[model samples]
Every structure is written in C-alpha cells, then in structure tokens.
Target: MKSNNSLTPSYFQFTVFADYGPLRYLFFSLCLLIYMIIISANVVIILTVCLENSLHQPMYIFICCLSLNSLYGSAGFFPRFLMDLLSDTHFISRPFCFIQMCIIQLYLGHELTLLTVMAYDRLVAICQPLHYHSKMTFRTMLLLLMFVVFYPVCILIYFFYLASSLPLCGNKLHRIFCTCWTVIELSCVDTTVIRIASQFCIVISIFVPLSFVLYTYLRILLVCRRSSSDFRGKALQTCLPHIVTFGNFCISLCCEFSMSQYDADEVNSSAIITLSLEFLIIPPIINPLVYGLNLPQIRKVIFRFLRINQT
Candidate 1:
C-alpha cells in the first residue's frame, strides 16, 4: 500500500491515490453518466421554476432548493470522482479534501434544513391554506436559507479545525470522495468528541427533519381524506417526490453507516463496493430519476425542450 509519509512545504497541495485497478474504469463511466443527467435535469428544474412566474410559490421554492442542493452536492464530488477515476488516481490532498468535505457537508446540511422548512411549508399550506401566503413569504424563505447555510458552515469549520489540528498517520481513504467522518477516522489521535459530534449531526440532520416531514405528510393525508378526490389526488402527488427522495436518502445513509464499521485486518472489498454504490452512485442516479420521471411538469418541460431543440 502507498503511504502519506512524504510531505512538501507548499501551501497548496494535490495528491493522487488511484489503487482500485480495473474498478476505476467502471466507476468513471458510471459517475460520468449520472453526473451529466443530474446536472442537466437539476439545471432545467431550477431554470424552469425561475422562469415561470406561476412556480414562484413556497412549494416550488423548496423544490428549487432541493434541486440546487443536489446539483451542488453532486457536482462538487462527482466530476472530480470521474476525473480521478479516469486518470487512475484516487488520492486527494489535505486542503482539497477539506474543500470537498466542506462542500458536501454544506449542501447536505442545506438539504436537511430545507427539508424541515419544506415540512413546515406543507403544514402551513395544507393545515392553514388561508394564511400560507402570509406565512411563507419571500422574507421568511430568505431567513430560512440563511439559517440553512450558516449552520452547516459553522459545523464544518469546527470539524476542519479539529481534523487539521490532529497529527496524520494514514491518509489512504477507502471511498472515492472525501467525507469528514472518514477523514476524521484516519486521524492518529482519539476521536471521541468527533464521534459524538458526528452522531449529533446525523440525528439532527436525519431524524428531526424526517420527523417533521412525516408529521406534516400524515396530517396532510388525514385532512385530504375529508376533501374531494381531485383535491386529494393533487395533494398526494405534490408529496410523492418528497417521500421518495427521503426514502432513498435514508437507505443510502444506512448503507453508508454500516460500511463505516471495520475489522482491524482490513475493511474488505464487498463492504467498500456496497458503500460506494449507496454513497456515490445511487443518490445521484436515482434521485433525479425518481423526481423527474414522476412529475408531470418536469416531463412536459423536458419533452418540450427536446422537441424544440430537435426542430
């Protein structure tokens, strides 16, 4: 195995650790296809939502946030992943790894925060339709955005500070992308606080938002039962994408968490492959497919755009 013993005094750093052999080719191809589709679809969604005045509501605003966050999150890692795979290089420099981890965490944190806000928005719209206009205004959205962005930055800054302060022992990352927890795991010192911090972050990011979304959707469904069929159908359709996205995310997270456990001998190939699919491949590939394939508006927009381009 290659090592991180040698070091240069340069402030800016770059490292390559491409040791996956033939799997690199497979990974590069998969990442390229998924990255292209995700970027194209997310860009179209955001632009269409922006261009159409009718879509400038709280629901679409949250959709835009989801699209933008996924776009940024996937773009930040996937392109480099493909590039590194193509070049047969998997190592990331300390600073570059930090930047990548920060971007990933920031976008993910935005996703969680936006999900919570979306739940609240749904609650207001469904439970208090008369006051939705007054409640989910532009100013409220802006505040929510700030909070979402700020909370993640603070969390990451502390993580990077702690991570960088530690003396490095090993730097060979098992996965393609640079994750904060994985990087922290390679640290020489005790990571008790880091472990606790990570657990706290996961609980806040996953369960709290999950709980709100579940509660809001449950209440919405209950109320929908009393409404006309047409109204009920529309409400259910609006919530389907959210439910699907959350489910996929939860599955991927569980897979990731499982793979983080290791035997002292080695982490093994099967676990790595499983974790890779869950973390790197599935979310980017499946999320847009789930949301885009189901949504009538997105399908119509995509078809129209393709037809216009062909003509």
Candidate 2:
C-alpha cells in the first residue's frame, strides 16, 4: 500500500485497476477487447464515410469528426495502457507523461467541442431545414474545424504550462497514463491556481457542449410540435442515439467529480469503477453501438460489407 507521499521518481504506480485477483486480469482483458472494438468500428466509419460520397453531407462529416476524435483519444490511452497492464514497469518518463497528457487532453477536448458543433448542425437541420445546406457549408465546416483545433490546442498549452509548474516531488503517476488532474495533484508546490484553472476549464468545457445539446433538443422539440406526426417520430428516432451518448457522458462527469474528492485509499472499488466507466469505455463503444444499432444506413452497409467479406 503506497501513500501519496511515498511516490518517487524511480517507483512505478498505476491507478487501481482491480483489487481482487481474477477481477484485475478480467477487467483489463475486457477493457482491451472493448478498446479493439472501438478502434476497428471507428476506422470502418471513417473509411465508409469518406469512400461513400453520398455520406459526405454535414451530418456525416460531423460523424467522421467524432469517429476520428474517438480514435485519437483511444489511441492515446489504450496502447500505453496495454503495456502498463501487462508489465510491472509502470514508471514513465516525466516528458513522456506530459506528452501523454497533452495528446489525450487535446483529443478528448476536441471530441467535446465537436459534439457541441454536431448538436448545432442538428439544430440547423431540424429547426431551419431549408437553410441547413447554406448554414453548414464547407466553409462553415472549416471554421468549426479551426475552432475545434484551436480550443484543444489552447487546452494542451494550458495543461503543459500548469503541469510544468508542478513540482515532480516523485514522478510516480498513479494512473495507467498521465491524466491532466492526476498529474496536477502530484505537484508539491502551491496548486491552488492550477486547480482553479482546471476547474474553470472543466466547467466551461463540460457545460458548453451540454448546453448546446440541451438547446438543440429544446428547439428540436418545438419543431417537432409543428412537424407532421411521421416526421416528428423519424426526427426523434435519429436524435435518440445522440441523446443517449450525451447522457452517458453526463453520468461519467458526475462520477469524475465525486471521485476527485475521495482519497485513493478511501475510494472504494465500486466508486473507482463508476468513475472509470464512461471516460475510458463509453465514447469508443457508444459511437459504434449507437451508429450500428440506431442508424439503419450504417448497419445496412456494415452487414452488406460483412457478407461480401464472408464470400
């Protein structure tokens, strides 16, 4: 049992993956399989969307963006994670840790921003159907892309700046990888400013996308009231998957906030488990599942492709 103070540059530490014997291996294995599914499914989406030009509308473009973002995030976390899971050497170089944190945050932040953008795209499509094409043109897409890249870049810079200020004390990162707040906590120096900055970032980043989703849905509901019954049902069905994905994220955020307060020792296995669920697993898994289960076009293509492959 290592205390927070016991961490040193030479020591290897990892977040509590599992405390029970078989459960650790089983959980890690499960996560590995889920990660693979995430990668494979997202890759399919990207390729299918790009090659099938019929899918190259504003909606599909946003889907491609979301898939790519998920890939970027999963790629950052999963490889190093597999290594850490299998090996006793959990210690990572400080620079490497910073790199991990930056890449992860950049991708994850972009995912959040893209979701908001997508929600807006949906809003335009549903609420101002005639203007959707004009409103969400290639130029508009490019502008949104710029913002997506820009905000995440700013987040990365801020993370590095605040991370650099933190004293290494001992370079043991408790997590499988260098998470932003996790790294921030290890600093022995005054972390009040950094902590405050991070909290502000979290609030803004979390709420903006959340608000976008909510507002889009609210308008969508109003539009539905005016729409024909069939149109209303179809529209609601299309939006259901996004709503579920967003809901999962909201749950994860709440878990993260709660877990942030508990000491590692004080944090029960169930508590930690709850915190890990959505962040590590949901986006990758949910993206594919939502698309496959809810979107008939994608599922038809997937099935057709699979049948062709089997032949």
Candidate 3:
C-alpha cells in the first residue's frame, strides 16, 4: 500500500472543513434532504411530461428538458459533496477533480443555453402563434435540443483540455467543489492563454444565449402589449414561470462567478460554499415547483396522479 504522504500530492483537499467544524453532520443531513427533494421533484416533472401525452407540445417538452438538466447538474455535485462531508480527509483525486470541474461547467453551459431555448419557444408561442406550429416543428425542436446539449459539452471540453494541459504549482483547491476557474488558479505557469480561452468560452456559452433570451422576451412583451387581455393573461401564465426560473438562475450564476473571481478571498469559506451551491440547490428544486404549480395542465396532471396513488 502507498504511504499517506506519497498519496497526499495526488489529491486536492477541500477547504470546507475549516468552515463546518462540528456542524458537518448537520450540514450533510441538510444537503442530503435537499438533494433527495431535488431528484424526486425533477423526476416527477420528467415522468409527468412523458406520461401525459397532452404535454407533448414544445413548451412542455422544453420544461422536461429543463428539469432533466437540473437533475444532471445536481448529480454532478451532490454525491461527491455528501461523500466529502462524511469523510475525515476531504480529498479528491486529480482526475476526479478535473471530471467534477467539467461536469459543473457543462451543467452551467447547458442550463443557460436551455433557458435561452425555452425563451425562444415562449416567444414563438406567444408572438407568432400562427407560425408556431410550422416554425417549432418536430425537426426544428430536435435540432434545438441537439444544440442545447451539444454546444455546452463542446465548449467545456475545449476549456477542460486547455486547463488540464497546464502545469500545477500546487494542488490545494479552496472551494468545497472543484470549479474550472479554481483549478486554473492553481496552475504554476502563466495562464494568459487559458484565461483568454476561458473568457471566450464564457461569452459563447453564456452571453450569446442570454442576449437571445432577452431579445426574445422583448419581442414577446411587444406582442403581448398589442394583443387582447386574454392573450396577455395566457402569455403571462405560461411565460412567467420561465422568466422567474431564468431570473433566479441568472442571479445565482452571477453570484457564483462573482464569488469565484473576486470574492473568494474576501468571503468566508462557508458563505462562499453556500453561494456556490445556490445554483445547484435552488434552481433544481424551484424549476419543477414553478412549472408544476404555475402551469395548469401540469398541476392538474400531478394532482390527478397523486390522487390515484393515494387510493
């Protein structure tokens, strides 16, 4: 067996131990509860959409995709996290660390792009209802879904490749989980090239979709203004959930980026972990609730299913 000293250099130690102290078990239990809720809630939404053929429209399909993405994102972080909380040595292997970083990045990219897709779907449904069916055909939606999944993975892969190629002077990552920027910071050599590449990836992965989402919503607002009260109400009922989800996601993302880039040193370890975790925790739970409660059809189906199961 390898000596502990020999193995120490091969892994990255988590800094959360300093923050949690005696409360680690309590924290772990809380996270476990939240994760279970996240998984169950998203799964329910996924099944509801799948089983209810009435939810076969583009809007509901996109909601399913969003919930699926939530589960994907949460899975990437929570399992490893819960394990770390239980362990005495909060260390992760180098390869595993890189893998975690990639998953988190991919999750963020996929989420922003997916939200943008949902925005476009809403815009077409409200502003161009006449052409909505023709425009958002099965083929069109398939392509959009493909893009939603593909683009993020591609961007993250490139960035991960670049980050992995760098020589690390040290192995200690300050955050609870491995993030790409944190990994990049641990590199010994100049990371100017990697930094530029990362910035480019961030723009392509986040800002482009954000711009499209904003423009789509602007057009949606214009269309709703000119239409009758019934149209406006219907649009609000459908679009509000997406808007709230998007806004919450964006705010959490902004906090994550801000903390990682600027406030890592200034913020307490516990605060940083909480902020970093918000994107993973809040969005997964809220997305399904927002959609299930706000979308009448989904709410009705969910209630009907619960009633049947209760009997």
Candidate 4:
C-alpha cells in the first residue's frame, strides 16, 4: 500500500452526484439558465466599462475586473458541472482536475484582491477627495490590476508544486469540484507540512484582503458620519453595491469553507450540493446585478446602451 501511495491516479471519482432520476433534466435546465445569465450579465458589465469613457475611472474599472473574474471562474466550473448534472459517470482526469483547481483558486484569490483594491479606491475617493485622482493614477490602476491577477497565480504555483509532488493513496473526491485541501486529503503520506502551508496561504489569501477591506469601509463610514446628509448619500450610492457584493462573497465562501473543512457524511446530500455550489453560483449572478442596478453611473450607461441598441 505504501508503494502504491507513490503513484498518482489517472482520474478522480466525484461522489457528490446522486440518482436524481428524471429530475436531472430539471437540474440541468436550471443550471444552464444560470450559466447563460452569468455569461450575459458579466459580458454586459465588461463591455459597458470598456465602451464608456466616463466609466474608465478606477471604481468602474475594478468592477469590470470583478465581472471578468466571475466569467473566468464560471467558465472553469459550469461547463464541467452542467455536464456532470446529466452524466452517469462523474470522474475527472487528474490533469483536468488540476486545471479546474487552478482556475477556481485563482478566481477566489483574484476576487479577494480585487475587492480590496476596490475598497482602497473608495477609501481614497471618499476620504481624501483631493488626492484621489493623483493617487489612483492610470499606471497605479494597471499595477493594482496586475497584482490582483498574478499574486494568486504565483502563490498557487508554489502551493501546487508542493501538492503535485505528493503521492496519492485514493482517487475519491467527496465534492463536485476539486479544491487543494480536498485533493490533499487523499494523499497517503503525512500532510502536516502541506496542511500548515495551506493554512498560512488561506490566511494570506482570504483574511488579509478582508481585513483591509473592512478597515477601508470603517474609515469611509467614519468619514461619512462627519460629513453632511448630501455627502453621506453620495458616498452610500457609490459604496453600497460594493458592500453588498463583498458581504455576499464572504457569506458564500464561509458556507463553502465550512463544508470543505469538516466531514459532512451525516448531512443531507442535497444540502451538501447547495453548500458546495453556493460560492460559485450566487456571487457571479449577484455581482453584476448589484453593480448594474445600484450604481447610478453603471445603471445609466447600461440603460443608454440598451436604448441605443433598440433603435
């Protein structure tokens, strides 16, 4: 058995899917609807930000980046997911599983960094109105965007390097998609080193951005309180959508994290699936809607784009 532990399996079995009977088609239809909506909504936001010169500002640009990340993440998950919904076999090849894991982790990492960047942008715009433009220069925006993207990829390269070197004793993944932790759990060797490294990375990946974002919001709220009602309203208008998106992202991730960290054998399988997919399903759909409907600048431009196309 120890000798076999050194060998990587060709594929992994996903034990999450059940016999939904004929309802599998229903599940497929609903998920397909969701995937389409995610694609359409995110594409609109990305296009809106690109075409509108006014929305080329830092905030809207960050929002576009968020939408782009959503698309990236969804593409990684939903195609495989939608297929698994109707398929009898749910096995994924080792290489493709790693690819999916990379996409998802990068998506998660990019999201946190991007949100933190958005918070910093709002903090500067609201708290230090005079220095906002000078501080958030075009060059700075590009740099920040680059950081949001490659920081996670770099971290994952190191982490996956460690993960890939490990020899696996099992091929069963308890969830629909691959995550680093879950895959690591299948290793036959002691995972103490990997576990500690992953925990450290998790803190850096998840908590650091969240803490900074919270600090920024706290500062903005304090600033809003000191200002007049009109100023408060304007600040809220700009920040509300971001706050909602941030909150939603956190909640979804918490649910997914809880499921991943614990043994969920006794829990209902339907509930398990919901918890697993919640992180991927909710945020992508909600992000574009929140920013599209709540932010006046985006809402106005989206409407104008629609009206122009109607003519």
Candidate 5:
C-alpha cells in the first residue's frame, strides 16, 4: 500500500453540506429560481443601458457595469451551487476549484474598484457639477474600467503563486464552494507568510476602496449641508441608490471575511452556510433591483423594452 503522506488529494470533499433529505429538492428549486431571476434582472439592465442612447452617461454606465459584474459573480457560483444542492456527492476537482476562486476574487475586487470609481463620478457630478463632463470623459472611463477589471487579476496571479506549491494535508473543505483561504488552511506546512500576504491583499483590495468610498460620501455630504434644501434633496436622489448598493455590498463582504477568517475552523457549519451564501446571493439580486427600479432613466427604458417585447 502507498504511504498516506506521499498521496496528495486530487479532489476536495465539502464537509459543510447538511443532510436536508427531502427538503434538498425544495432548496434546489428555490435556488434555481433565484439564479434565473438574477440572470434575467441583470440582463435587462445591461440591455437597457447599452441600447438606450440617453443612458450613455457615466452614472448609467457604472450601473450597467455593476449589473455585468453581478452576472459574472452569479455565473461563477450559482450553477455549481445549484448542482451541489441536488448532488449526493459534493466534491470538486483541484483545477476547477482554483478557477472558481479566481472568478469570485475577481468579482469581489472588480466590484469594489468599480464602486470606488462610481463614487468618484458622483463626487464630481454633485460637488463639482460644472466639471463632471470634462473630468469623466470617454478616455477617463475607459482607463478606470480597465483598472477595475485588471487589478483583481493581478492580485490573483500573486495569490496563486504563493499558494500553488503548498503541500495539502487534507481534502475536506468546510464550506460550500472553493476559496483561496480555505484551501490554504489545508496546507501541510505553516502558512504564516501566506496569511499575512492575504491580509495585505485585503487591505489593498477591500479597505482602500472602502476608505475612498467613505471619503467621497463625506465630501458629498458636506456639500449637501452647505446647499439649499432643494439641492440636498436632489443630491440625495442621485446618491441614495449608490450609497445603499455600496453599504449592502460592504455588509455582505464583512460577513464573508468575518466568517472565512475567524469562524471557519470552529463555527457551526450549518449557521455559517446561510451567511456565506448570503454574500453570493443577496448582492447580485439586490443590485439590479435597487438601481433599475429606483433610477427613473433605466426604469423608463426597461419599461419601454418590455412594452416593445409584448407588442
């Protein structure tokens, strides 16, 4: 017989899956319905933003990008997740796990950077209305989009470099899906360096954007206070949805980070699963609804599209 130490795991088993028995089907059906809604809702916003000439403005374009990112994040997790809900075996291959991690990390990073840029856009629009058009020009938006999408990619490369060579001591993951940190926890050797590196990544990837977002809103708030009531109401009308979306995403992110880093080893698996999935489920569904329904321009265009489809 081969030595256990010499054998590396080719697949990781998910240990967090609860035995729901007959209720699994009900859970699967509900999740499938949510996935469908996420797709359809985000797609409608994307199509409306692209097709309507009036929506080519920076605000609408950023909203479209949020929907696009939501679609990307949802596609990464929901299909595999839906399958797992109905599956008897919850195992994922090593390579596919890495791919899923990349998709999720990219989605998270892209989201924050995109939100940061949107905050900047609103800052200029509300605080410096005369300079908004000139400041957020076509080239500027293109460069910002490039930064938002690519920054996460660069971080993923470094993360994989640090993690790829670590010898695995086990193959059972205590979560529903793959994550870099979870996999790193399975390493046979001490991972102090890797953990620190990850913290650094979090500060750069999460904290910086979060700080910038807060700063922008502070400036916006100050401007609102100094202006008339009419101006304050108009400013709130423009910034409210973005603020809600940003805050919602931050809370979800906090749940994911807190559960992953602090509670992963010892927490009740059943309890963490709900909050873990909340980050993946809530934001994608909520983002488009908040933006599409609350914003009159996108909502008007979406209604027009629906009317055309019906007729």
Candidate 6:
C-alpha cells in the first residue's frame, strides 16, 4: 500500500454531475442568469438603502446588512460554480479549495448572525416600540454590524487553521464545492478534536440564532393577537417579509445539511447537487425580491430609480 503522505493529493476533483455532457451548457447558462439577477437585485437593495434617507432607520439598516450578506455569500459560490460548469475537468487546487471553504463558511455564519440581529430588531420594534430607538441606536447598530461581519471571520480563521494542520489521506471531493466536513473526512489522522469544535461552533453560530428568531417571532405573534387591527396590520406589514425570508433560509439550510450528511452512494448525484446548492442559490435570490417587493419604501425607491434610468 502507498504511504498516506504519498497518497494525499495536491488538487481535488469535483465529481458531481461531471458527466452531464451537452446539458452542462444549459445548466451554465441558467446559473449565470440567476447569478446576474442575484447581483443586480442585491446591488439595488444596498444602493436604495444608501440613497434613500427615509430608509436610514434600524429596520432598513438591517435589510441593507441582509442584502450585503446575500452578495457576500453568493460571491463565494456562484462564480466558481459557473466556471466549473463550463470546464470539462472540475478540479480545484488544494490551497484554493481551503480558501473557498473558508469563504463559504464565513458567508453562512454572517447570514445567521445578521438574521438573528434582524429578529431582535423586529422584536424591539414590535414589542417595545418606545425603546426601539434607544435600544437600536447608531452606536449599537455599528457594534452589531461589526460583530456580524467579524465574528464569522474569526471563527472560520480558527476552523481553517485546524483544517490546515491535518495531513490528508485523499483529495477527491464528492461535491461541487469544498466543505470543512468533507475535508475533515479526508484526513489521515484522528479528527476527534475537529469534530468536537465543529459541533460547538454550529451550536453557537446557527442554533442559538435560530432559537432567538423563533422566540422573537412567537412573541410578536402573541402581541399581535391582543392588539387593535390597525396595529396588527402595521406589524404584519413590517414583520411578514422577515418571517418569510427566515423560513425560506432555514428550510434551505436544513436541506443543505441533510444532503451533506446523507449517504452519498445511495442518493442520486443530481439530487445531491441540487440540495448542496439550494442554500447558496435560493436565499440570495429570494431575499432581495422579498424585501424589495414587500417593503413599500424600498419598492417606491426601486421604481423611481428605474423610471429615472429609462428616461
């Protein structure tokens, strides 16, 4: 048998749907279109929030953060994915694979943190209206924004550090992109420490925020039930979009995790590819649309801009 060091590869091959043949072009075209839309829509949201003074409030600031996160996350995945679609041989350099994994993980972590902050923002706005302004002050918002962006990056730096120390036994990645778990599985050494750390990170990064979102929404629902219809309508108008976005994102993430954990040999390759890409593809597209269409201020700003550009 070859030595483990010798067996380790310098590059990883993506074997997901590599045999699609002619259909690869079709998939490439579709993905490129969606990616363009994601970029365009998210840019609109960021620019709209920046240009419109009326949207300088805490809620809209949160929306802007969400849009930025969408762009950040999509940037990590779509470009490489599109490139892979057009390539006959889908391989990534070992260093680039680790870079990609870190970026993708950062995106996921930032997204959940931002959403959790948004949920808290909504909770304050609806449940403690008078305190909303005081609680979500400019200083507070700035701090939260910093935390959202940096917290994930800090965690992922350590994650990559741990991953980098391990000696690999193999280098063939089964999925379209590199993930920490997949890379960990390729290690020749024991991964007990890495596994324990990953579980802890997941709980702190994903589950805690998810729980907060659920709790905040539940409280909002209870409060809405007792309030006047006008108040209820106002609450619904603001909170409904957040709820929808949250639900869609959570479901997509669940699908991603489930597919990642599933028995790859038993599952269809196409299905695995679809599930793997869902969280990356769906949320970025859905989020900007949901916010832009549902929020009247944003909708008006978008229309006004469109009309100006048309003239």
Residue pairs with colliding backbones in model 6 are: none
lDDT of each candidate versus the true structure: 0.70, 0.74, 0.85, 0.88, 0.86, 0.85
lDDT of 4 by residue, 1-311 (tens): 46653478889988979989899999999999999999999999999999999999989999999999999999999999999999999999999999999999889889877888899999999999999999999999999999988888887887677657678888888888888877888877788877777777776777888899989999999999999999999999999998999998888777776666676465567777888788898999999999999998899999998899999
- What is the Cα-based TM-score of model 2? 0.87
TM-score of each: 0.84, 0.87, 0.93, 0.95, 0.95, 0.93
- Candidate 6 lDDT tens digits, 135-219: 9999999998998889888877776776676777877778889888777767887877777777677657668788899999899
Clashing pairs in 3: none
Better lDDT candidate (3, 5): 5
Error of 2 at 119 (Å): 0.5
lDDT, candidate 2, equals 0.74
Per-model C-alpha RMSD: 4.0, 3.7, 3.2, 1.6, 1.9, 2.0
Best candidate, TM-score: 4
Better of 2 and 4 by lDDT: 4
lDDT of 3 by residue, 1-311 (tens): 54444433577878755545779889899999999999999999999999999999888999999999888878889999998887888889888988888788788888888889899888888888899999999999999999999987877776677567756666777788888777777666687777776767675666777788899989988988899999899999999998999999889878886776563567787788788788889999999999999999999999999999999
Off by over 4 Å in 2: 1-12, 15-28
Instruction: Give the TM-score (vs. native) of candidate 5.
Output: 0.95
Show where candidate 1 strays beyond 4 Å: 1-27, 263-266, 301-311
Measured by lDDT, the strongest candidate is 4
TM-score of 3: 0.93
Error of 2 at 284 (Å): 0.3
lDDT of 1 by residue, 1-311 (tens): 32445222112222323377788788677767877887887787788678767778777777777888888888777767667766744456677877887787677677667767777777788778899889888999888878877877776677777666665666666665676666667677788887877778666767777787788888998899899999888777767777777677777766766666553237656556556556545665565666667768766766776798899
